[model samples]
Target: MGKIKVTQVRSNIKRPQDQKRTLEALGLNGIGQEVEHEATPSILGMVKKVEHLVSVEEA
Candidate 1:
């Protein structure tokens, strides 16, 4: 499978609890932090939930 780059582009403050947890689930702890994950359904779903808060790139 291919890998995806997930970067936190925005702050999680004032966001929903679920969105905060979703960001954490993707390994983003702060603005500008990044993590590489598999391009799987589960991860994609998480990314969709917080799409506005993150930037995704194929890696």
Candidate 2:
């Protein structure tokens, strides 16, 4: 299976609660934080939820 590298490129502070939670759920705690995860429906959902705050690349 392919994997994805998700990087938090923007700050989540002052954002909606749901967006903040989405970032946390993706294992991103702060800006510049990166997490490697298998490309799956759940992760894709979370990424979509916070697409403005993160950048994703195939890993």
Candidate 3:
């Protein structure tokens, strides 16, 4: 699978617990933090859940 870069673009404060957990799961601790992961179905699903808080791009 291709690798994708996921960047936390927004704060998780005031967000739902699940969303916060999703960000943590993606290895993001704060805004501007970026993590690279394989573009697998599971990761894509997780990204979709918190799409508003992060930006995804080709790695």
lDDT of each: 0.96, 0.93, 0.96
lDDT string for model 1 (33-55, tens) is: 99999999999999999999999
TM-score of every model?
0.97, 0.95, 0.97
Q: State residue 16's C-alpha deviation in candidate 2, in Å.
A: 0.7
- Cα miss at 33, model 2 (Å)? 0.6
TM-score of 2: 0.95
Worst 10 residues of 1 by lDDT: 19-28
Question: Could you tell me the TM-score of candidate 1?
Answer: 0.97
User: Every model's Cα RMSD, please?
Assistant: 0.5, 0.7, 0.4
- In model 2, which regions exceed 4 Å deviation? none
